[model samples]
Target: MKTPGHIRAVSRRTVLKGAAAAAALQLAAPFIIKARGETPLRIGMVDPLTGAYAAVAQNEVMGARLAVQQVNANGGILGRPIELLVEDSANDVGTGVQKARKLIDRDQVTFLIGDVNSGVAQAIAQVTNEKKVLHIVSGGHTDTITGSDCKWNVYRVCNTTSMEANAVADLLFTKYGKKWHFITPDYAYGHTLQKAALADLQKLGGTMTGNELTPLGTTDFSAYLIKARAANPDVLLVLPQGSDMVNCLKQVAQFGIGKQMHVAGLQQELESLEAMPPEARVGIWMFEWYWKQPGVSGVDKFVAEIRKVNNGKVPTARHWFGYTSVHTLAAIANKEKSLDAKKLAEALGGFELADDVKLQPNKCYYRKGDHQLMTSAFVGEALSQPAGDPEDLFRVDRVVAGDKTAPPEAATGCKLQWPT
Candidate 1:
């Protein structure tokens, strides 16, 4: 006979081998009492660990792992060691829901964080909300996470499509050109970003020459490249992400289209860019975080530590998302003096954290109306001439304030509900 919410727990130090090993570790007692007389603070994380987005996902998990170690080293949250139980979402909506339920109902995780795919994130959100568990969207970028589909217990750390579009439109239009063409993934996320980008660019006297809707995980973009080249737009905005992004850009360069037209996009992940050769990496794009920005307190220390752990490989924005998500939740839990979902929700509303980035008035917060994290958006250009270090790929040119980047609260259509 096994008890409910019983999953074998592993310490922060153990490396989870695979899904089976991770599941095997979840035997009974999801919330394990340590020999130190303090119960563990469990956090369940689900993401696409082995799929098109696996490289980016790996960095995201590393970020969370670093944060967990940092939190535990500092006496843990509220004097209890934090235990992280991870599940591979596999980039499938059904798998995401199953994992979410397992974490909530069986593992009894204190809260949840996840999901790279917007669709998968939404599916997991439903489960966490039903279980009354607080979840932070650490990587998902679809507008619905903080829009009409928002839930009371859910929060988003990543910028919405509108946020990225609004933030970078003017900069890109002015710097690149006013005439644009799009290479978008034929999916909800791509459609949302493409629509937002077009709308924002149009406001600045920009015109869309063409938009090529490519299926996700497309390998050969020769046909799309031919269409984009013929359209002869001033800027080619590649809107697909993850492997789609890597593939399209590489093919674009190979097709010699990049040489004729300026290349750009809505968002970029350093991990994704690292996968491509320097010759293949070209374009100006939106970046949520950069490891080498100047005058930021604790950034150098973070970069140094991550580099040490990853054999001198620098951390990326995805890593920061995971690191920030865990630390922010733990901080809020400590501040509210409890991990109750309702209390945490109330505390997060209008809560402010002073970030050292120095770009956004040194502060970021969750909007009371939408639970969207108000933070700066950065524009980075892949350097044409490498200054030697392969990691020194992008040169961050501008950092837009969050207030200036995100749309007005009334326009977002998020109606948050609080407990009685």
Candidate 2:
């Protein structure tokens, strides 16, 4: 039983003790913060996660997520963890631009990557350029993204339409025939791809039998297939990608179009082939990246890691695009010791990717003139049945080097204007 004065004295001592403890904590706060390390470096990724390109776009996101995990595990970007903020473009140009703005302004991301749809990718590029954010076009293959519409800050991981066309044109002409018919998607990507392919065909003295500009997200491709078969072309090019490609090829097989003509296209994805039936998976095409490269330094490890998150599915080109995009930013930023967009952009112009990151036999580097990745094109024929693994649906015929297929930098119409 203490007196009221004694209780008050005890209370005062307790309050003084708390004050001293608080001061001690204040003194240790800086050390604690230093030990905890700096805040995460944010990277914003935009893609069509819920539309025609959803499967491939989601794969891209998956690859980016893995790269983020790898980056943070190593030492992170400039000793800071990487925070990847992903937003869905929904395959719309307007939505892509809006998402890009949200990531740049509200989220304050240091870098940006996106878009399977070339139109959406270009739209996002405008926003990224205005904001001066370092951007990587992860999957979009329109020629102008790294050509006429290219910006100082925008670099592309995927091959250009011209590169793809150059890769497969000779093979198609020699193996198939001279007359070609096309069922092309009506978009920037399809348009550019068709134009480039046509240019190559003409250069090889091949004649275009017909070209049907099918709308994006078209579920029924019977009419287009009918027109293509009716043309009686030596080869029928099914040029839509992602779900669209799956749909087109499915209808082509159902209608027995492949039996009538040699079916092929320029760029094909593992995601699309997986979605397709056995009969529909007949084509000669080019893969931007393939998971089945024997003796490739990092491909096996990459495939194993991707399988962990991708439901045991092997990685497609889209995944490599996303993975390479994030790693590119991290590698350049770490090397330069700065996140300045211009510095990173300048350094990236002729930067060569490491063997592990490249995952291909060829020397992969970003071309200085156009900021386009010079990666090998996996030219192959789609298998109706799995050769070995269930997911091994493609047999690589030849791995063409980018420098061998791609035109001279002067011909690409890419005049990179660096910021002063």
Index of the highest-lDDT prediction: 2
Off by over 4 Å in 1: 1-35, 354-361
User: What TM-score does candidate 1 reach?
Assistant: 0.90
Lowest lDDT 10-residue stretch of candidate 2? 1-10
Across 1-420, the per-residue lDDT of candidate 1 in tens digits comes to: 011133343342224354322322332223333427788778988888777777677667777777776667676778787777788888889998998898888878998999988889988988988888999998888888888788899998888998899878887899889999999888667788998999988889889999999976788889888989999999999988888788888888777887899988889887668767677788788888777776777788888867755656787888788888888887888888887899898789888764532223346788888898987887878764668766777887888777778888888888876556
**Which predicted model would earn the best TM-score?**
2
Q: Name the lDDT value of residue 116 in candidate 2.
A: 85
TM-score of 2: 0.91
Per model, how many backbone clashes are there? 4, 0
